[model samples]
Structures are given as structure tokens and as C-alpha cells.
Target: MNFTEQALKKPRALLLLGICFLAVVVVLGFFLKNSLISAEDTDVLGDFVVRRSDNATSFFTFVSSIFDPLGTIILSMLAAGIFWLVTRNWRYPGFIFGSVVASAAFTYALKFAFHRSRPPLLDHLVDETDFSFPSGHVTGTSALLFSLAVVLTLRASSRSVRILTWLAAALLVAAVAASRLYLGVHWFTDTAAGALVGTGTVAIMSAILFSQTKQIPAS
Candidate 1:
């Protein structure tokens, strides 16, 4: 392997890095919730969203609707099925399942800990309840897509395929985060924290699994 790849393959280093990132995100998220709930940020963004065309609003509404908790679970199940079929191994499938679960669990835990309220009813395009410092939909979708991308890229043979897969996965995650903002369901910081949490879960899981196998999959 090249020097850069060699450097990045240190499992311990990667694990530490992931933990640090997750901690920073959680702390930052706690602080940002205060500013996000203030009238300045919410009012400005809400006003901008109100002016958008009906079709555009509907599109984001659809995007956020399909990325809810139930939808994320279904996607994870399907991913597990695909992982099993492709690799014919339980190891990667189990990893995917665990990572997805971890993502959801942590997202909710953080939400409860913060107890931050969602955007005002007046600003909401779709009504939602419960704490919303970090968006559950964004977290789960990011975890599922990002983990799938990492797994697929590791299994792929061609450099071009790996690059394309990473790009596609990134775009999907960004779109989901954007939907949360466009639909006025979450603040920008909420989605930001969600992305960090999701990515950190994948990173920690990957480091652990990689340490066991050296390579992610035997195939």
C-alpha cells in the first residue's frame, strides 16, 4: 500500500480519531441548540423557505418523510440482506446492523439529553414532536448510506468504482440533510451534528471490524 493508505490503516489511531470527533460534535451540538432555537436563525430560514415554489417544498417534504425512523430501519434491513447476498458472510452484515442500531440509539440518547424543542409550529412544514437538537432522520440515513459506501468501496476492485461510490454516498447524505433544512424540521446545526454522529459510528465500527480481519471482507 502507498504511504497515505498505510498511515490510515492504523486501527487504534482511527478508533481514537472517531471517538474524539464524536465527543466534539456532541459538545458543539449542545451549545449550538441555544442559538439555533433563537428567533434570528429560525425566523430568517423560515422566511426563506416560505417563499419557495410549491413543487420544491413538496419535494423536500417527501425527502424528509421517507427518511424517518421507520424508513431508516427498513433501509438497514435491506442493506443487511444485500450484504449477506453479496459477501455470503455474516460478519459484514452483522457489522452493518450493529452500526445502524448504534447510530439510532445514540441519536435518540443525545436528543433526550438535550431536550431541545423543535422549530416553532408556525415555522414547521410538517409537524413533529419530541426533542430535536440533532435530527434522527439525518443521523440514521447518514449512518446507513455512509456505512454502505465504506463497505462497498472496500469490496470493490476498481479505483474508479470506489471513487464513484463514495461520491454517490456523500451526495445522498447531503441531500437528506438538506431536506431537513428545506422542510424546516431541523436547524442547520442539528443536521451538522447528525452527520458527525453518523460518520463517527461508521468510523468506529469500521476500525474495530478492520482490526479483526485486516481487510474489511474476505471476498
Candidate 2:
């Protein structure tokens, strides 16, 4: 392994990353909470993103909304389960599972807190009227990818394998986020916020899970 790779493999590196990630999340959340809402920016972002989702009028709505959501959750769960099954490590999947719950909870909390309105340029692919500050799809997809990266980095033996795994995870996250915007379902800002919150959620979850795992002795 190279110097950077070796350094990253250390427990201290992971722990430090967790600490910094959590602190960043706290700061970002505060910024979002206090920043003034801009209708002009919201509309502009919504318009630009909705262009990607111009297929909103197509029959793909069912596939985009239903299949995408189901696929994201199911894929993440399956990946986590596969890891645990092969490695006989339950805590690994546990971490991924915990990330999902936390991401969803925090996403909803921020959604309601912001009370942002949906894009008026286009109708939603699926009915959604409550709040639309941050796109849940983006956040959910981000969490899933982040979880996959963490799992792969933990278990993969080779540098090539780890790099490939992370690349795939990042691509998957981007695709999902793009799909949401391209379907005109979410504003650009919404997806951006989702990505931020989702990433932060994964980091925080990792830290919490590691702390708990530390309390248990290795068998």
C-alpha cells in the first residue's frame, strides 16, 4: 500500500474522519437552518433541474418513482446482507442499516424544518406536497453509496479492489441523484442539500457504530 492508503487504513484515521465529518454536519445543519430562504434561487434551481426531468410527462414516472426508490433501498440492503453473509460479521450490516434509519430521520427533520416548497414549473412525478427543501431520493441514494464504500473499504484486501468499489459507489449515488432531477421531481438545490445531508449522515452513523462496536470484545 502507498503511504496515503496505509495511513487511511489506520483506526485513528477512520476515527478522525468520523469526528471531522460529524462536526461538518453540525455546522452545515446550522447554516441551512439560519440561511435566508431565496425564492428566486429556488425557482431558478428548480427550473434548471426540471429540465433534466423533462421526461416527467412520459410513462416512465412509475419506473422512476416506484422502481428507483425500491431499487435504492433494496440494493443497499442486499449489498449489506451479502457482506455479512460472506464475512460472518453482523456489525457491518448493522452499520449500514443504522445509516439508513438515521438518514431518513434527519432528512425528514430537515425537510419539515425548512418547510420549502416544491418546484412550480412542473408537476411531481408522484404526488408530493409537504416539503421539498432537500430531495429524499438524493439523500437516500447517497447514504446507500456511502455505506457501500465503507463496507468495501473495510473488507477489500487489494488497493485496486477498494478504489473500484468506491468509484462504483460514487457513480451509483450520482446516477440516482441525477434521475431525481432529470425527472423534474426535485430542484437542483434539493438534490444538493440531499447529497450534503446524506454524506453527513453516513459519517455520523459510522462514528456511532464504531463506538458501540468498540464496547464489544472481539470474539
The lDDT leader among the candidates is 1
lDDT of 2 by residue, 1-219 (tens): 332234333545555665565455456556655776467546654664546434544534543564343466776688778877776777677767767667777778877776766655465455666676577777777787787677667645678877888788777666666666555566666777777777777766665665554342121
Candidate 1 local lDDT, residue 83? 79
Report lDDT per candidate: 0.76, 0.64
Report the alpha-carbon TM-score of model 2 versus the true structure: 0.71
Q: Which segments of model 1 are wrong by more than 4 Å?
A: 1-8, 33-40
RMSD each, Å: 2.6, 4.5
Candidate 2 error regions (>4 Å): 1-71, 121-126, 211-219
Model 1 lDDT tens row, 30-95: 676555465655765676577777988887888887878779878888889887998798867776
Candidate 1 yields a Cα-based lDDT of: 0.76
What C-alpha root-mean-square deviation, in Å, does candidate 2 show against the real structure?
A: 4.5
